[model samples]
Target chain A: AQSVAQPEDQVNVAEGNPLTVKCTYSVSGNPYLFWYVQYPNRGLQFLLKYITGDNLVKGSYGFEAEFNKSQTSFHLKKPSALVSDSALYFCAVTSGAGSYQLTFGKGTKLSVIP
Target chain B: DTAVSQTPKYLVTQMGNDKSIKCEQNLGHDTMYWYKQDSKKFLKIMFSYNNKELIINETVPNRFSPKSPDKAHLNLHINSLELGDSAVYFCASSQTTGGSQPQHFGDGTRLSIL
Candidate 1:
């Protein structure tokens, strides 16, 4: 079975500081990973996806994620945190062997304090 | 333009009542899906339709029925609303059912059962 794990329930960072939201996964085969962000009372917006490419993937809103196959991790990152970036982040994974539905993590709430 | 849209952003009804949430995607995708987010914010795939055919059906109860009139539209109908059904329902679409196609999600509908 494919699964995703988000270790942090919440991540706090100061404005203009670098931020990271941790994510890990367990899958039997090659994994297609994705990152999504959700604001309060809103649906999720796709941030980026890693579908067999360079380790570093850039996404919307100045966000990026590093895909580490050895570490089994795909952590979301931002060079400089913005208050507008504060939202719930979800890490999802799907197996390359015909698993079309995404296995999402519980999500990590990111708070950028001004 | 909204790539994916869902109707009734907020719905409040009594137990035993029936309700439906409409969803449409303008991205010309071939696959549509329904997901439920529980109080703990755990997102789970409920059903999926590809080219108006049932593709993925999770372990959801039969009370939750998803209808896809066409490739661009998918709607969810609940037979009998229950308190446990009070949560956010999201409609999503993808270019195809499998492979690395990314799914686009709607704003979601908050359903409350009194």
Candidate 2:
């Protein structure tokens, strides 16, 4: 079974400081990983996805993720954090050719303090 | 225009009552899905429809039935509402020609069971 694990339950970062959210996955074959952000009382918003691309994938709102194949990890990163960036982040993975659904991790709540 | 939308953004109902949540996508995507998010922000795929055909159905209870009238619309109808059913339901869609793509999600419906 394909599964995703977000190690941290919450991450606290000061405004203008760099932030990172950890994510790891276990899948049978090649994995298509994605990052999504959810605000309060809102559904998830797509950030970026790593299907078959470069190791560093850039996404919305000055966000990027590094896909470390050896580590089986795709950690979301931002050079500078803003107070409004505080939200729930989810990392999802799916088998490339198996299922169309994504297996999401227990979300990591980001708190950006100003 | 909204890419994807779900009706009844907030639903408060009593136990044993029946309710339905309607979803539609104007992105012209060929695949649509339903996801449930618990309070802890753990997301799980409940059902999916591709071209108006049932492509994936998770281990959800039979009381939760998803109906796809067309490729652009998918609706979920619950037979008997339970207290456990109180959660946020999201509608998502993606364009799947050969490989799956990043899904676009709606603003989710918050269902409260009394």
- How well is each residue in A1-114 modelled by candidate 2, as lDDT tens digits? 999999999999999999999999999889999999999988899999998869999999999999999999999999999999999999999989656878999999999999
Superposing all C-alpha atoms, what RMSD in Å does each candidate have to the true structure?
A: 1.0, 1.1
lDDT of 1: 0.93
**Cα lDDT, all candidates:** 0.93, 0.93
Query: How many Å off is the CA of B24 in candidate 1?
Result: 0.7
Model 2: residues >4 Å from true position, as ranges?
Answer: B97-99
lDDT of 2 by residue, B6-99 (tens): 9999999999999999999999999999999988878999998999999889999999999999999999999899999999999999997333
Give the per-residue lDDT digits (tens) of candidate 1, residues A1-114: 889999999999999999999999999889999999999988888999998879999999999999999999999999999999999999999997466889899999999999
**Model 1 B-chain TM:** 0.97
Local accuracy of candidate 1 as per-residue lDDT tens digits, B23-63 = 99999999899999999899999999999999889998899
